[model samples]
Target chain A: MSYELYYWTGIQGRGEFVRLALEDARAAYTDVAREEGDDVMSAWLDGEHEGALPFAPPFLKSGRLVIAQVANILHYLGPRHGQVPDSEAKRIYAHQLQLTITDLVVEAHDVHHPVGAGAYYEDQKTEARRRAKEFRESRIPKFLQYFEKALERGGGRHALREFSYVDLSLFQVMSGLDYAFPKAMSRHDVPLLRALAKRVAERPNVAGYLASDRRLPHSENGIFRHYPELDA
Target chain B: MSYELYYWTGIQGRGEFVRLALEDARAAYTDVAREEGDDVMSAWLDGEHEGALPFAPPFLKSGRLVIAQVANILHYLGPRHGQVPDSEAKRIYAHQLQLTITDLVVEAHDVHHPVGAGAYYEDQKTEARRRAKEFRESRIPKFLQYFEKALERGGGRHALREFSYVDLSLFQVMSGLDYAFPKAMSRHDVPLLRALAKRVAERPNVAGYLASDRRLPHSENGIFRHYPELDA
Candidate 1:
């Protein structure tokens, strides 16, 4: 049975992390919200249909099981798709790294919506500018340094010794940050991460997906938005 | 073998979620950082020790296996301590709820540190005020309502049908929010969540721990900080 993924359709937001893993593994899945309208995603959020109720979208349904949270979804898919090691210890290690990535993602989103998620970006531009300054100056470098050190420890090929979902996620996050803060990212030194993103993109299945129409472009409506003022 | 939990002293913080489960199960574990000193925690963060490297603290070491992240630690301890269901699907569901709680905790922290975690809370008072306004007005109510609806769906006892680590975590989040924003939380109506918090507090092991010296008081340095002006 094909896995069914439900998320917002317009941009490569949090859902992209999960999508990248499925595509990298050449797993057959359906992007439910993209095929069926936003109403279907809204209905699940409203609890109109039943399984395990997700607080938000980007949930996966496979047979009788449903899972939410990007890391959790990847955790389930990792071993099945040969993206992560089989040992219990390595699995936990991969999860720890993924959780840290999740932290970076939250911080990235907060740069734009520091004051509020419900408010418009125009309304919170002042606070966003301040938040983005700190993000570019401190957070981005610190997080990149952590990933760089991890990559070095793992022999500079993947997040672990071999290719894994964590590597795929790191690639997606790097791409998003590069798109959102081209000047800042270029100024910062993250050679290891940049190399990993290029490596992941060249994978046969990943390259095919990126070249195909299934991949969505980064837009302002998503988590990583490029407002020129926030970059500097 | 006893578990070794490494976290900062003086504040419940993220470590409390793991502590509550260990305490609730009457499991034998050593609070290493509290017993030792900050140096021990610092060394781990600096990657001086072996095993999987954690980007930060609140990591657990069980024999040769080491795990980090609050949710990941709880996910490891839940089934081992009889705090979660045995089925894979239920375990995944419990994890999803715990991830939601993690998201809420991040928001609570951001209310005080809107600009950057490296800076002092007093330095970002202006941004804090704006962030807190949005948090108190929309984020808290929406999160509490989501938990309330989850509790209602689970028969008003726990986040799941049975007592799980998710319940322990929900209780901690509610207590922290109450201490941080007594005025705002009191004004908001989250009857189901409030009731669940009370229920979890009354559990035998939970009550014992709360009455013991191990239960640290909420302080300004922790994730949930009480700044009166921001609350208003």
Candidate 2:
């Protein structure tokens, strides 16, 4: 069956997390938002489908199904796409890891949009600086430590070994941090993270996707941005 | 199999979302943190099991399985426990709604903590005014609108015909907003949400839980605080 993914057209945003798992699993799916003049994302949220509807995008459609939330979408597709463990317990564990990655993603977004989403990043620069410092100094390390321990247990450096969905997302996390806070991340004791990123990059499917046209470049438009002041 | 729940003692926090679902389903589980003493939250985060480990609390342990992330845990248990949809599509939609509720929870916490988690609400009161105003003005209506539409789609009143996991979370969100911004929620167009809270409260299990000692009350020590200054 052809799976349809609904998300914004241009930026990777949260959709990239879902994309990584699908690409890594070699799942056959169409990126619906990028399709020509479809307006499918809005349609999906506008209640075109039956059963339960998603509150927002990065949702998936498999036949008659419409699934949403980045982690939830991945959780729904984990076993089917060959990206996670089969048992009920391991499945929940994989989703738990993805949700934590999602939390970090929100923190990353708030580094730029601290005061409010309606207010421009420039308008909230002061708050962003304060939030960014806290993010860089405290949260990043705390979250990374957890990921490191997760990696340590899952088989070290590879983060859930065999390169799961969370690993790909973590790779993006390091990539975004490096782009947004080059100085701080460069100074961080992230040898394990760096190694894992390198491994994720070397994965044939991901390497191909990164080199291909489908992969979007890091931009000021997305959650992670290159703001020199926010960086340490 | 026995389900073991790991969350902080004293306050419900994010764990209460899962706790409500578990209780409503009458699922048997141990509140690990309360059992081992409140400070045991840290050790629980440290992974007190073999195989898979949780990065933080508000996790669930079923048999040898350890799961983290409140939304993920609830999504994992909701169906089997009869608190959620049975289909994959419906399941993901329920999860998406729950994740959005989790977002609101984080946002509500940040209403008091826009500065940083490392800083106290007292230290960040000034910044919180700016954040809380935005939350009340923009975020509340925006999220409440989404819930309103979901209710409309589900045939009005309840957000999914029968109560789902997100409906339980919706009750908590309503409860939280009421505590955080009494005047704002009181004046807002959150009729569906307010109604959902009443419905969830009247649920035999939920009402019983809320009345029982098992339910934690809202206080200044938790996410939704009745800071008179913070309120409208």
Candidate 3:
């Protein structure tokens, strides 16, 4: 059976990570919210689903099972789509890397919504400036350094030396960050990550998907919003 | 071989979630950072470890494999300790619940450090107040309601009807929240979660561990910090 993904229809956001994997593997899946409406995603969140209820969106349904959380969904997809290694040890390692990416994603999202998720960005602009400063100066460098080191350790190819879902995620995150913070992310500094993003985009299916109408553009409503003043 | 857990020695922070599972299963493991020093954790984060490098603390090392991220570590431990169901679908459900708990933990932490992780609470007190307000008013109720609904669906016993690592982590999170937000979390409001926490604490191994010196007290440094002004 084909997988069914539920997420917001407008922006890439977290759902893009799952979309990249599905597209790369050429897996058959439906973007439920996009085809249907926002009510479908809200209905699931309101416990209208039969199985496990997700706390948030970007959840995947496969046959009888439903899974949420971007990293968790990717973990389930990785092995099934041959995106991750078969060895248990390597699989777990890939998960660790994916979890780190999740952390980075949260921080990226917080750059705009620093005070609280419930509050509007305009209300928290002062706090956002402070948070974004720290994110751009320290957090970005630290996280990029960690990934760069991991790439160095993994022979500077993929997150695990093989084309795993982690690489796809890394590519997506790097692309988002580049779009979000064009000034902060220097090509000279994050050479390995930049190269990986380029290579992943060049992949047959991934490239096709990127150029296709199926790919959504980043927006202020999404996680990686490009606010000029917030960028260094 | 015994598992080795590395985390901060002081407060029962993120590491406590892992500790609860280990203690509940009566698994043999060493609190390496507590016995050794913070240098051990720092060294690992600095990529001094042989295998996967954790972005932060509370990573587990079992024989040749090392795993990080609280939810990921618990996901690995759940099946190994029989805390999760053997079925793949149920196991993934347990993980989805655990990841939700992780989200709550991060939100709880952000209540204190809303502006920046690098900045002190005093430095971000204004932002903290705003963040804490939203957390206490909206986020707490939403998360508790979700868990309450899950409990209702799972027959009000454990997160999955059976005693899984999700229960252990949920117990830890509820306990921390009680200590952190005595005003926000009332017995009348979250009866199911309150009962679950009570039942979890009454477990033989868990009770013994809580009363033992191995159980660390909640401090200002941990995720769930009790700032009087922030609570109400």
Candidate 4:
């Protein structure tokens, strides 16, 4: 049976991470919201469907299991799709890296919606300016450096000994960061991550997905937005 | 063998979630930073150790494995400590609940540091006021209602069919919220969560831990801070 993935039908939000893995593994799955409508995703959120309740979207339904939380979902998929190493220790390490990525993603999103998600970016422009400055100057460099160091430790080829979901997610993050903060990212130097992103982008499946209509472009509506005022 | 938990010395922060589970399970573990010093924890962050580097502290070292991220650490500990159900489905449900708690915790912390963690709360007092208003009025109730519903689904006493780390973490979150925003929390009604918190506190091991010096008090230094002006 094909897996059913439920997320909002616009600019690759958190759901993109899942899509990348599914595409890379050549796993047969349905992007339910995109194929149908937001109402289908809303039904799950409203508890009209079975399985577990997700606090938000980007949930996966594989058979009877309904998994949420990007890292949690990836953790489940990584082993199944041969995206992680066999050893338990290495799998734990990959997850820790992914969780750190999750933290960075939250920080990146908060730059545009610093005050609260309820308010529009125009309303919170001033707060976003303050947040964006910190994120660009300190936070981004800090996270990038960490990932670069990890990549170096893992032989500078993949996030681990071999290709894993962490590499795919990192590619997505690097892509998002490039879209969101071209100016600031240009100043920071992360040679290993740049190469990894390049390699991930060139992967046959990923390259095909990028060239296909399935891939969505980043917009102001998504987590990683290119706000000229927010970018230094 | 005992586990070595490395977190910042004074504040509970994210480390408290792990601490609660260890205490509840009566697991042998050392709050390493509290025992040794911040330098011991700083060494791990600096990557002087052999294990995988954590982006920050609140990492647990067991045998050769070093697990970071509160939810990830709890996921590891829950199974070994028998804090989760024996079945895979139940454990995943428990973890999904824990991750939701993680999201709520981040939002709660951001109320004080909306601009960025690099700046002081005093410098961002005006921003905190705005963030706190949304947090108290909207975010907290939404999360509380979700947890209450989850609790109702699992059987009113626990976050799962049996007592698990999710319930323990939920108790810690409720206690922190009460300390942070007593006025706002008092206004919202979540009978199931309130009852679960009370029951968790009465657990003999947890009650003992609460009375001991090991459990730190909530303060401005921690994730959940009570600023009278930010409250109400």
Candidate 5:
């Protein structure tokens, strides 16, 4: 049985979070658009006959059943992939953490595109400057505190601390944050969270993928981009 | 056999989502804050608690384990309580829908808060106006299209064609939107979605919940507020 992932091929974007989970698990799958091209992604979503997948990017097709949402995809891949725990409770807990990470990801995306995703960041620069400041100030602490507590509550060691799917996502998010707000993150002094990112970076498969060509470097095109003005 | 639901007592807020599901199942549960008071909600989260129940309110406590997140709480309650299906694939699909609902909830919240939840909506009114327009226009259609397709894809007249946990969420979201933006909703004729909302509203358990004092009425304090200005 083959697995196919449909997403915007180039930018790490939302799909990267799913990719990290699969890459870390060494799961067999195809990044459909990355290889086949956008016509495929477009056709895959808006083809004739009106039969399209649910939502957009980061959908996983396992046989006939197609699943969307980044957290949902990871939740599906986690158990089948051996990346998440075997226990039902543990799995659900990991999913909760992943969902929280999704919250953080949306916040990051908004820092740049506070007006509208369809509109250019330049078009929304005035509003974005306002939104980004608040994001760096208020949201980071509120969301991160919730997560730091989740790590603490979920047994704070790693983001998952027990080799769960959420940890991989936490790593990806932290990486994105680092790319986007290096100064802010450095000043924040979240030592444990930094350590957690370092630990996930050291994972054998993840580390291998990071070093290999398959992994894309964080860039301005992605959700988390380094804009010095926004960071401050 | 006792269920304890933990959430901030005062604001019906996100906790209400969980309340709707439990009430629909007609399950026996205690709103912990309602019984235990505000201090208990704070104390439950305080302390160097690792693997603590959940990151925030709207958590469910069954004996020793504390389940958190509205979606996660519902996921835990769905199968055992019969709000969702028993099959693993169906369960995942149920979760996919809930996660999408969660995203929608975030979007709704962002409309008022825009950049910061800690700040007042009036403070962000300028930004809110811009965000609200996008929410009413773009986000509504995007989410509606996906859910409408999911209902269609479920291969029956009903969504998931059966009463799943997501069906209630879809119904609730539609209710929230209608209340929040009656003018906008009235202008746009989303017949498929409107039909789904009606079906969910007429469900035996849900109908009972809406009639009972147990279900909180839609208000300005919650995610979907009926602000006339934002409606247009």
Candidate 6:
């Protein structure tokens, strides 16, 4: 059966990470929410759907099991789709790296919602400006350098011995950041990560997916947003 | 060999989640950083140690493998320590619940540092107040209600089929929230979670650990900090 991926319709958001993996694996799947309005996704969030209850979206339904959390969804998909190795140690290592990416993603989202998600961006713009400065100066470099080092340690190509789902997610992160913080990212030096993103984008399936209508562009509606005042 | 857990000293922070699992299972382990010093943990973070490098502490060095991320560490420890069942399906379910708890924990920390981690709480007091209000009004109850529903679905006592690592983490979260926002939590309704916390605390092994000096008190230094103004 084709995997049923459920997330909000408009923005790529966290759901893109799952889409990238499925796309790269050439796996058959349906973007349920995008195809059939968000009411379908809302029903799942309201606990109308069966199986595990997700606190938020970007959940995947494969057979009877439904999984939430981007890293958790990727962890399950990695081995099954040949995105990660079979070894237990390697799998957990890949998950650890993915979790680090999750941390950075949260920070990226918080830059615009610094006062809290309940408030509008316009109301929190002052706070976002302060938080974004620190994110661009310290947080971005720290996380990017860590990924660069991990890529180096894993053979300067893939994040592990072989190209895995992590590289795909990293590819998404680098792309989102570039779109969101072009000026700030231009000043940073992370050659290995830059190269990995380039390699991931060139892969046949990923390249095809990127050109298709399936891939959504980044905007203020998503986690990584472009606010000229918030970037360098 | 006994597990060597590394985390920052003084503050229970994220490391306490790993510590709870070990204590509940009565597993032999050393709180390495607390005993040795921050230098040891810093060296590991600085890539001076072997195996996969950690983004931050609360990493466990078990024989040849070093694991990071609280949920990932618990996913590894749960089965071995008899904290979770043997089935892969049940284990992943437990991990999914733990990941939800992880989300709440991050928001709890952000309440006091809404402007970013680089600034001091005093420096960001204005923003923190705004963030904390929304956290108390919405985020806290929303997460607690989800856990309450989860507990009800899981047979009303533990977070899963049996007393697992997820339950232990839930207990920690309940206690931490109560410590950080007593006034707000008092007004909220989460009977199942409150009862679950009590039951987890009364567990023989968990009880013994809590009574000892090993369990640290909550304060401003950790994630769940109580600033009177931030509470209801």
If both were scored by DockQ, which would come out higher, candidate 1 or candidate 3?
3
Q: Tell how far residue B227 is off in model 3, in angstroms.
A: 0.6
Alpha carbon lDDT of each predicted model: 0.90, 0.80, 0.90, 0.91, 0.78, 0.92
Per-residue CA lDDT of candidate 5, range A1-232, in tens? 7788888867889988888888887878898888888667665565232322455677888886778888888877887878787877677778777777787888899888776677788877888888888888877777666666666654567555577777777788888887898777766756667777788889999899889887888887888988888987
Which candidate, 5 or 6, would have the higher lDDT against the true structure? 6
Q: Which residue segments of model 4 deviate by more than 4 Å? A: none
TM-score of each: 0.97, 0.94, 0.98, 0.99, 0.93, 0.99
* Distance from true location, Cα of B76 in model 6, Å: 0.3
Q: Write the per-residue lDDT of candidate 4 for residues A120-221, one digit (tens) a residue.
A: 999899899999999999999999998998898898998886999999999999999999999999998899999999999999999999999999999999
RMSD of each: 1.3, 2.1, 1.1, 0.8, 2.3, 0.8
Predicted structure 4: lDDT:
0.91
Model 2, B1-232: lDDT tens digits are 6798888888978888888988888888888778887676666667555756676667787766677788878777887877776765566667778888888888888878886888887888888888888988989888888888888777776666676887888888888878778888887776777777898899898889999998988888888888888777
What interface-residue Cα RMSD does candidate 6 give after superposition? 0.8
- Candidate 3: stretches off by over 4 Å: none
lDDT of 4 at B162: 85
Residue B70 alpha-carbon offset, candidate 4, angstroms: 0.7
Where does the lowest 10-residue lDDT sum fall in candidate 2 chain B? Answer: B43-52
The 10-residue segment of model 4 chain B with minimum total lDDT is: B42-51
Worst lDDT run of 10 residues, candidate 5 chain B, spans B47-56
User: Tens digit of lDDT per residue, candidate 3, span B1-232?
Assistant: 7999999889899999999999999999999988888887887888876888788888999999889989899999888889998888888888888888888898899899987889999999999999999998999999999998988878899888888988888889888988999988863387888889999999999999999999989999999999998988
- Model number 5 iRMSD: 2.3
lDDT of 4 by residue, B102-213 (tens): 8898999999999999999999999989999999888998999989888887778887868899999999999999999999999988999999999999999999999999
Q: Lowest-scoring 10 consecutive residues by lDDT in candidate 2 chain A?
A: A157-166
The CAPRI quality class of candidate 5 comes to: medium
Give the per-residue lDDT of model 6 (tens digit) for B1-232: 7999999999989999999999999999999988989888887788877678899988998989989999999999998988897876677778889988888989999999998889899999999999999999999889988888888878898778688999999999999999999999999888888888998999999999999999999989999999999999
